[model samples]
Target: MSTQNVAERAVIREARPEDDAAIGELLVEAFITQYAKKLPEVVYTDERKRELRDVAARRKVATILVAEVDGEVVGTVALFPPGAPGSEAWLPNSADLRGLATAVRFHGTGLAKPLLDAAEDLARKWGVDAICLHVRKGAEGVGRLYMKRGFVREPVGDMDLPSVFLTAYVKPLK
Candidate 1:
């Protein structure tokens, strides 16, 4: 199908319990598969995979949003309130966004934008002054999307994890 058609028909909504497995699969495919080349194989430990697959665990702390195309889950993103565990939000009154992943087949189909829009809208509704997120430094394409959407790179917030380096980005809502 055409990119435009796929994007036009996609629905962005809060994920239901039944979506847990699909979201987990999408996250693993989008992250581990793509980052394996740039990151060390050791990073793909079973524990890490389990962490990526734990959508229900994340749902307890964040609002899990998914994009469904014709009844198939194709994309997912997590929006976390400030002070929530695993939240990298440093700016006061900011929300944290993470796990923005799209299925390989849906890459470049403009699906991420809607997921991001929904997160930003939810952030505004929650009275946050900004939305913060971390992107793997090697994921230039994903970083570009955030930059294009007005997320400013905050080098001071960059993190050097044992397996991967992350660059922080923040977009002010005010």
Candidate 2:
């Protein structure tokens, strides 16, 4: 099916507690399994996998949004307002996004854009001036997707972590 067709059938909403496990599984599947070749093995450490699966902990500081297709969670993205625990935003008054994941089966189904759109909408609602995120440095396709969605590379916000180097992107809301 085409991206538009699948996207039309998808529902985007804030995740409920019941959806936590599925979101974790989806994250691992999309990040570690599906895009394995796009990142280094070191990036997929046991700690990182646990972090990906820790939906409840992450939810404490950010709003977790899920994309549902046929009543199943297929994608998720976390939006963190300024000063939230997970936000690595360097820009003042910016919201940060993390853990943007789409199930392997939904790849090329355009579910990502809706998920991102929802995050941006939420950020706007929170009165933030911009939304920012960091993508793994080597994930070219993911970076392209963000760029195509109007997120500009903000190299000054980039960071180097023990697991992977991150490249920053930001989308201005006003």
Candidate 3:
């Protein structure tokens, strides 16, 4: 299929309760596949699994968008105020797009870009002046994707982990 066809086949919309299990599984599978080679396998363990699963089921509390193809969910993301992504850090009036993941089969299928674009739009509708996100400090590749999408690196907040640090970025929507 042509690249445009693949992108066009994907539909971006709000997630539903019935999608919890699929969303959870996709998050774990996609995240591990992308980061396992670069980071230690131990970090992607049971606790992490449970966390992703629980977070998926709770997406209703905020704006969670899912990408679907031919009726199957292929990716997901959410927009919330700061500190909603299990972090205590706060960025007032900014909606932080978090919990993003794409199914392995759908990687590079343009699913994530539109999901992000939708999240930014949601942020604007919610009256937030900016949209924000966080990435592992050493994850320059992941950070580059956000940078290319208009997010600017922010010097505030740090999520210090044993294996890596987390840094924040923001894209002005006002």
Question: In candidate 3, which residue pairs clash?
Answer: none
Q: Could you tally the backbone clashes for each prediction? A: 0, 0, 0
Task: Please write out the lDDT profile of model 3 over residues 3-90, one tens digit for every residue.
Answer: 4555578789998888888888898998888887655543677887897887554674566789888788888987775545443324
Q: What's the TM-score of every candidate structure?
A: 0.92, 0.94, 0.88
| Model 2, CA-based lDDT | 0.87
Give the number of the best model, judged by lDDT. 1
Which model is ahead, 1 or 3, in terms of lDDT?
1
Tens-digit lDDT track for model 1 on 39-144?
A: 5443577887899899999999999999888889999999999889888888888999999999988887889888888889999999999999998877777788
Query: So what's the TM-score on candidate 3?
Result: 0.88
Off by over 4 Å in 1: 1-4, 37-43
Could you give candidate 2's per-residue lDDT for residues 27-141 as a string of tens digits? Answer: 9888887566665553477887898999999889999999988888889999998999767998999999989989887788788888988998899999999998998877878
Give the residue spans of candidate 3 off by over 4 A.
1-4, 40-42, 82-89, 161-164
Q: What C-alpha lDDT, on a 0 to 100 scale, does residue 47 get in candidate 1? A: 83
* Model 2 C-alpha RMSD to native: 1.8
Clashing pairs in 2: none
